[model samples]
Target: MSHHLASLMVAGGLDALTYSSLAFLIASGLTVVFGMLGFLNVAHTSFYMLAGYIGFSIASRTGSFWLALLLAPPVTVALGLAAERLLFRRLYAAGHTPQLLLTIGLAYVIAETTKMIWGDDSLALAPPTGLGGHVVILGATLPVYHLFVIVITMALVGLLALLIGWTRLGMVVRAAAIHPQMVDALGFKLSAVHTFVFLVGLYLAAVAGVVMAPMLGIYPGMADDALVQSFIVVVAGGLGSLPGAFVVAGLLGLVQGFGSVFLSDYALYFPFVVLAGVLLVRPLGLFGRGGA
Candidate 1:
């Protein structure tokens, strides 16, 4: 292989990794919320977008990306909790229609509120002082912030695995996802479990938003594109399946990154094509359960 080709491949791979990292961050939360609640949170990406805007505000005022990162997720998660307590909790047994309508309305309201506060103009956020540099790998220049994203995502994946696999809360969450009535029968508060799961899921999205702010910038319509991409990931990976989300996220990222180079004219359509193919083969999704 030629040196230049190797460099190009490395660059593409890194870009794919970065994209996959972001997708997984968003989709993981969405899937978890769906898994526990048995309904998709349509406003999930709106929370993600909201976090970016909030993070930008903090960073701008405090002049510290780290501060924004530390503070933004909790703020976003608080709003999610508020929505859950006041709005979503009422719709738990109301079926998909009510849940869908409520969430979509919430999404629109959040979007409009963000525009009112931040305006429609896009805003750029610079990386932290230390992460502003780049390193050469396989003769390709790789940004340190991208590396930071990949590393942080991997760490979170490990943390999530431990949380879901070994912790009592995780066990309760899994049980609730499969058999809510039985969980309620066991003297556990099903509603509390649902609320906690939602909190964790939204926190993940908030973290993703703050982390991605530097890379993607803050904008009004950002959540819509993110929503589409993340829905594709959740559906393809199997709703509520973290491993499925992770695998499909990597695959979609590679498709987008390489497609942009090899099939530039139709690159934008490639993800939807992948989604169509997945649905044709596995209507329930690659990792989704029988009913889901």
Candidate 2:
């Protein structure tokens, strides 16, 4: 390829990776909750948006991005835990419709409350010190913060793999995902496991929100866009498959990044098209199985 073409390709590739990283972070939680708990949380992205606003507030007050990073996720987790304990716990046996409706209502509440508190204007959160510069990659200038996001995502992926593959909690979670009754019969606390998994999912979303705030900005309807993209990733990857979500997120990122350049007018529909194509070929998704 010519130098210009090569640079464009490199830039697009980097953009794709960054997008994939963010999607994975957001979708992994959604997948995990669905896989393990069988509960669909339509309000998950609202938690993400809420955490971003909280992080912004914390950073603004403390003048410490590090502090916001440290604290915002826990606050998100607290709210998630409250929702699980107070609302979701009572509805586990009520089926999907009620849960879906409840979550939708929760999303609206969060959106309106956020607007009331923070106003409707978009807010910017700067990257941490030393991450605001540009770096040259194959003659392509890229934001250092984008690279940081990619690296952090990779680290979190490894951490998740280790958490889900090797530990005792992981074993119990895996068992519960497939057969909660059997796990419960074996003396594991299903309720506790469900709560933990739900909180973990929220924690992941909060991390993505805080980390991605610099790139995406905090806005009133930010959660809507994220929710749409995340739902696409989850459904396209398979309802409850983390590995599938990761792969699909990468595929989606590439489609979006390049599509925006080459098919600007139609780029908005590209993800839905990819989702449709994937479902048409493999109804169960790329890596989906009968259970978690």
Across 149-210, the per-residue lDDT of candidate 2 in tens digits comes to: 99988988888789879999988988898898999999999999888888888888898999
The TM-score that candidate 1 achieves is 0.95
Q: What's the lDDT for residue 202 in model 2?
A: 87
Which residue pairs clash within candidate 2? none
Error of 2 at 63 (Å): 1.5
State every prediction's TM-score relative to the real structure: 0.95, 0.95
Which whole-number lDDT from 0 to 100 does residue 101 have in model 1?
Answer: 97
lDDT of each: 0.89, 0.88
- Report the lDDT tens digits of candidate 1 across residue range 97-147: 999999999999999999999999999999999999999999989899999
**Candidate 1 off by > 4 Å:** none
Give lDDT: candidate 1, residue 180: 89
Best by lDDT: 1
